[model samples]
Target: MVKKKFRYDVGILFISAVVLFVTGLGISQGTPQKKNPPFEIDRFIPVETCADCHSEIYEQWENSMHSLSHTDPIYNRVAKFLRQGLIDNDEIEEAESCVKCHTPVGFVSGFPTRLSDDLTKTPEIATRGIQCDYCHSATSVTKMYNNGLVLKPGHGEDDPGIKRGPRDDAQPDFHDAQYSKLHTESGICGTCHNVKHVVFGTDLETTYTEWENSPYNSPDPEKRVTCQGCHMYQRPGIPATGSTERPKNPGAATDYSDERPHIYTHYFVGANVAVPAMFGDEEKSNMARERLKNAATIDVDIDPADKKQIHVTVSNTGAGHSIPTGLGNLRQVWVEIIARDRGGKTTYEKGVLDAGSELPEDAWMFRTVLGDGKGNPVINIAKAREVLSDTRIKAGEQMRQTFDMGFVPRKGTTITARLLYRGAPQKLLKQIPGEPIEPQPVVEMAKAVRTF
Candidate 1:
C-alpha cells in the first residue's frame, strides 16, 4: 500500500510540472518580441505596387522631395562628400547616418554605408526613396524626433502588411487598413524631418520642432493647421483607383457608401524647386515657386528721425515653420534691396548675386551659421558641431533690417526690396561635381517697392 501511495504522489507531481511548463510556454509566445538594430526590408513593397491603386498619389510623390531624397544629384554629391570624409576619418558608423533617412531601405537592410550616387545601381526599394509600404507598415513611433520609428515586416506578397492610415472604417479588398491617429498628426512627420548630428548630437534640423512651438500647433482646431494641411491640399475627389470624379473612398467598390469631404492631394509642395527643375518636372517646379511666393511678406518703412535710413521688414506670414528652416546652413534666404534714382541707375544694393551666382560678402542672409569644433565656420553639415548664430525668421515672426543710405538719395529715389530664397549657396554648388555652376533659381518670396 505504501509503494502504491509513493507512485501516485510522483504521478501527481509530474502532471503539475507538465501543466506549469505549458503555461510558461504560452506566456512566452504571447509576449511581444523586440526587434534589434538594423531592421529587415525584405517585406518592403516598391512604389509601383502602390501605384496600382494609388495612381494619383504616386504621380504626385514622383515629383516630391521624398522621391528625390535619395536620387537628387545635389544631395547625392553632398552625401558622397560626407561619406568620403567619414571613411577618411575611419568613422564608418558616422557615415551610416546619412542613408538612415535618405535611403532608409538600404540603411535598415544592413548596407547603410553603400549608397551609390547612381540611382540605377542602388537597390530597388532604396531607389524608390520613401515608398508607401515602408510608411504604412510602421507599427509605432518610438519618439518624436530623429527618425525613431518601428516598422513591421509582412510575411508574404498576399499579406495586407499591417496597413495603418488615418481612416478607421476603411475596408479594402487588397489590403488590411486600420486607423492610426499618429498618421494625421505632425509627430509622424517629425520622425524624419528632425535631424541630430551622429557625432556631436547637435540638433541639425528642427523643422518639426519649429512647427510644434508655433501658433499653427495651437490646440484650437479652428486655428490649428498641420503640415499635411498645407503641403497636401485637399479637394473633393476619389482617394483610390477609380474615375477621377468617383466618391472619396479606399476601394473601387460599385456600392459607393462612404464619401469624405475632401481627399488630400499629395503634391508635397515646398521651397525646393532646384531638384524638380533638374528632373524636368515643370509643374512641380512652378508649384514650389508659388508656395515660396506666398510664404512671406515684405514691408518697407522710412525712419522718422533720418530720411536716409530705411527699415525693411520681412515676416514669415504663411509657413508654419521658420522661413529657411531645414538645412539652413545650406539654404539661402535674404532681402535684396535695390534703390535707384529716377535714371534707373543702381544706387545702393544688398543681397545681389554676383556673376558666379555668389552673394556679396555684406549680404544679410536669413539662415543659420554652424561652426566646427575649432570654432571655424563649416559648410559641411556633418562637420558642424554647434550653431554659431540663427537669423532665420520664425513662424509668425518678423525681422527688420536697417539700411543707411550712406549718401543722401535723390528726392524720388525708388527702393525695391525682394525677399529671395535659394536651395543651395553658389559656393556649395560649385564644389559639387557635375552640377552646372549656373545661377540657381532665386525664388522671390515677397517684394515691395516704395518711393522715398
Candidate 2:
C-alpha cells in the first residue's frame, strides 16, 4: 500500500512539472513567442518623434483609423474574443495573427502579444497603430493579403534610422531617408487592405480586390488612381480618380521645406464616424460625415408606363471602390424611400430606422451575408464559414429599385428616395461585449425628391 501511494504521488509531480515547463515556454499562445526578440522595442521610433518636425501631417493622422487600429475598444474586445474562442477551437495561431497589422511594431519586434500578457502596460510606440515610422520602414510586400507587409526596422534609437517614402529628394536632418517607388503605388496598400482568413481561407476583406477590378485601376500609369489618391487626399466629394480632376493640396511637406503642389492628406477618411466620435474626435467625425454626404448620387421618378410604379436609381458615382467596401459583414448601406399624400400624410415608407436605430426587415440593405458552414448566418468574423450573399453596389456601377406604389399618385403627391449609410449593423452592436455603444448616427449620402 505504501509503495502504491508513493508511485501515485510521483506521477502527480511529473504531470505538474510538464505543465510548468509548457507554461514557461509560452505555449499558451500556440507558437512560442520569439525566444530571442529580433530587435529591441526602441528600434521602432515613436510617432511623436516624427510629430515634432511634421506637426500638421501628424495631426491629420492623429485620430485617423489607421492610428486607432490596434487600440480601438471594439477591435480590442473582438480580438480578445477571437483569441479566446480560437483556443477552444484548437486554432490559437490565428488569434496571434492580429499583431501583424494592428500592432506591427510588437509583431516585428516580438513584444509578446499573448492574451495572458498585460496589454495595459504596452509600450507607447506599440499603441500608435500604423504610425509614421512603421509605414516609412516598410521595405516590400511579398504577399497580397492578410498583412503581407515586409518591415526592415531601423537599426536602433541611437542610430540614424533608415526611412523610405515616395520622395526622392527627401533630406531629413535626423535620419536616413530614401525614395521607394512602392510607397507611391497601390500594391503597398493592398498588402494590408486585402485580407484572407489564415486558417479558414475565407476572403474576409475585399477593399483591394474591389479597387483592383475597377475602371479606376487603369493600365496607363497616368490614368490609374490608386487607393492613396482618394483616401489620402482631402476632398469634400470623392471619386478623385485619374479620370476626374483632383485639386492639388498645397502645403509644406515639413518645416523649412518647400511648399509642395500636393502632399497627400493623412486623415484617411472613409465612412467611419462613430468610432472616432466615441474617442472624442469630433473633427474626424465631421470629416467622415462630409465625405459620406458626397459619396453617392440618387434619382427618383415615377415610371412613365406604370403610374403606380416608382423607380429609384442609386449610383456609386463618387467612390473608386465599391459602396460599403471594407469589413463587408459589418458595414450597412441601404435606401430609404418615402411617399406622402397631398395632405402631408405619410402614405408609404420603407427602410426607416426605428427608435432604437434598428432597420426594419423590409429595408433594402446593401451588404454581405456570411454563413457558418452549415448555412447558418454568423455575425462574428471568426465564425464566418462562407459568404452566403453580397448585394453591395460595385464600383462605378448603378442599382435601380422599382417599388409598386399600390395606388396612383395624386396631383400633390411627393416621392422621395434617400441613400443612407451606417458603420455597422444594429444587431451586431448589441452582441459586442462591455459598455454598450451609442447607436451609430445615420448619414444620408444622397437624396432625390419628385412632386406630381
**Index of the highest-lDDT prediction:** 2
lDDT of 2 by residue, 1-452 (tens): 43663564366347435543554454533342353235678878788778888988899899788899878876786677656645435245555567667776766666545544677766778888888988888887655666556767786657847798878888888888999977887768887887655555566788887997898777666767888887777644543432345777888877777887888878888889877887899888888887777678899999888889998888887777888888887888999999899999988888998887899988888888888778998776666768888888888899988898788888898988999998877776776777886677888989999997
- Top of the candidates by TM-score: 2
Candidate lDDT (C-alpha), each: 0.71, 0.76
Per-candidate Cα RMSD to the true structure, in Å, reads 12.9, 12.0
What would the per-residue lDDT of candidate 1 be over residues 1-452, giving only the tens digit for each residue? 43663564366347435533543344322112234355555666777777777776788788688888887777777776666645433133344456668877766666543444344556677777776777777766654545666877564366656678877778866777788876887767777887766445556788988998899877677677778767656222211111112233243221343445655566667778888888899878888777777788999877778888999998887888998988888899988999999989999888888887899978878888888767888877667778888889999998888999787778788999999999888787677667465567888888999987
Off by over 4 Å in 1: 1-34, 37-40, 85-93, 113-121, 234-258, 434-437
Which TM-score value belongs to model 1?
A: 0.84
- The residue-level lDDT of candidate 2 at 149 comes to 67
